[model samples]
Target: MTTELRNTEFHIRARDGAGAEEHGPYELDIDPGRTADGDAAPRYASLRHASLRILRLPPGGSHTFATGDSEWIVLPLNGGCTVAVGGDSDTPFELSGRKDVFSGVTDFAYVPRDAEVRISSAAGGRFALTGARCSRRLPARHGPASGVPVELRGTGNCSRQVNNFGAAGVFACDKLIAVEVLTPGGNWSSYPPHKHDECRPGEESELEEIYYFEIAPAHGSAGLGYQRVTPSGASSRTGRGTDVLAEVRSGDAVLIPDGWHGPSIAAPGHTMYYLNVMAGPGEERAWLICDHPDHGWIRDTWPDQPVDPRLPLYEAPDADLRPSLNETVEAGPRPSLYEAPDADPRRSPNEAVEASPRPPLHDAPDARPEAHPEDPEGDAR
Candidate 1:
């Protein structure tokens, strides 16, 4: 299901489970510069700063395109690839990517705007081309996997791991900000509902964000997750507010133009992963946000609780101080607060509990205490 509400701000692109049709090599392609005719307002006006495209290549397949006015990062979701920008004399960058998103942090290649680029994967793989329209054209470069900062955020059921690879201060870019997040099965991340929709100087920056999700399969069945976005009494330049509640599966994507989005919930027995791509019109390329007043108090409870034991699923390539991907750490039964009812799996979690009262936060058992580092860029998602 592709929801392009030209009259509104929010949109969703759900993956087709029935294999009814194909969307070619690019599973999802969102270019704000491209617009449909006769629209009351450009469906992607708020997305003018950021763009995302998911490409799946076959064995020995290659793809080429011009960057135009956007700087992009060729990030492999699985397998490996070579990125080349400019003439044939230029040396192409070889990226030793990982087996999958859950495997470990993978290296990436950055290509500046107004250049021709080519990506070839000898063994085939899936790649995420996260971009942001920018005026400055920086030189193409490679980002080593060992350099990505892995941060453990929140505690208890809110525990999650964040891979700040293309973060504003972490990496150099004209306007792009990208990151990867991993949440253990049955836990919640992106909590304390936050928003970066308004330009309030030191408080918040009006950045549009794109969430690309991949749910780790449980047993032989496909897994699912849930995402929620509610209006924050603020409108985009086009005068449209955002609102969304969707059942997100692997290959699905959610576009948030302006709103309070959070609590990306992972279903039981399934690990959840999301790639966050963001960029805005702010003169200072920074990620600053304001937490929703109603749920902001939840962050206070994290200090007393322990982080989920299953986090840091895997460490960076150079780090041997933490557990590897193959090592299984026992995580006891999930807290009763997250237990799902006997309802349709396709329904959003919020919808499943719409008639009931909110569950109280319970301390997770069998977890170890880990320090929650303060993010210099406001709240850590």
Candidate 2:
């Protein structure tokens, strides 16, 4: 990889069929008050190297989850949860939710392959939980799952999560990490210069990253954001130094190959929400972002700012981050190149519900590909 490609970069948003091969700029909305075992089966996918299955649970529901041979991270996007990593263990980890908190659930609980887990949601709301394996592909190392006799819901794993990734299991390259970074309403993240290459002194772990944002739902007309990424002076892709100041809404995405990034510029009228996923071939999972050397130590001279009180972990996660009405933004629009029209399980399969040969969340931008225009066989959700 070139020096510039080591810092930050973006992949084209996942088109309809794009998710089948890769994951980027994708969105799946959940129906409120729905549970996993509901009428339609919740979605599940074992990507080339990882398996991520999500289910919505109603209040007072219990489910068993297995991590077979993979390390997993279980997060309840909404609602309060009781999770026991190694079920049957005497001590279980508990997370409470505030009335104003997201769907009322605490953040994710890291679960390693060393244990089996069970979860319960007390408050009724939609819950999105994903389980992905670790390490590169090898054999069928199935983690424990939502096993039998649990309830009227299907005890068996779905047909979709049963494909063989063969040589592409979890470890192909580092996959994901959960970071609780505090970027006050109007601050930035990767400022002051830093990089994560060369396992020497400061910069350990050499991994690629993905930034997923979750803004305060209530930032009505003013909640806008943007990112700036470009090549550093010493290493430019071309003789010219080009930089991009890309503005973003809730679901937009940007690519970063090099340069200094920051000042997530949350427009004057609102705050912002964002999550970043990083994975690469390095052993260390810790983060060490390098800034423009000239501006590197700016962090030492910066003052800490307080966060907005009305965001997630505080109040209810607003339904959808609607489009801004009549506001002007400094950054340009960053729309996804593709979209998954039938993302919700509650919706009946329309023309956009076919299967693909690529990974689960990375495919084309239109409808799911069909076998042939002349054939219309088994096409269930």
- Range of the 10 consecutive residues with the lowest summed lDDT in candidate 2: 147-156
Model 1, global lDDT: 0.74
Candidate 2 lDDT over 217-306, as tens digits, reads 453453556666555553254342335556665543343323445545554444454433444344443344444567544433322221
Candidate 2 ranges beyond 4 A from true positions? 1-70, 84-94, 98-108, 114-122, 126-177, 217-219, 231-246, 251-260, 303-381
TM, every model: 0.79, 0.46
Best by lDDT: 1
Q: lDDT of each structure?
A: 0.74, 0.35
lDDT tens digits, residues 44-82, model 1?
Answer: 555667888888899999999899889999999999999
Q: Residue 344 error for model 2, in Å?
A: 47
Error of 1 at 274 (Å): 0.2
- C-alpha lDDT of residue 141 in model 2: 18
TM-score of 1: 0.79
- Candidate 2, position 71, lDDT: 54
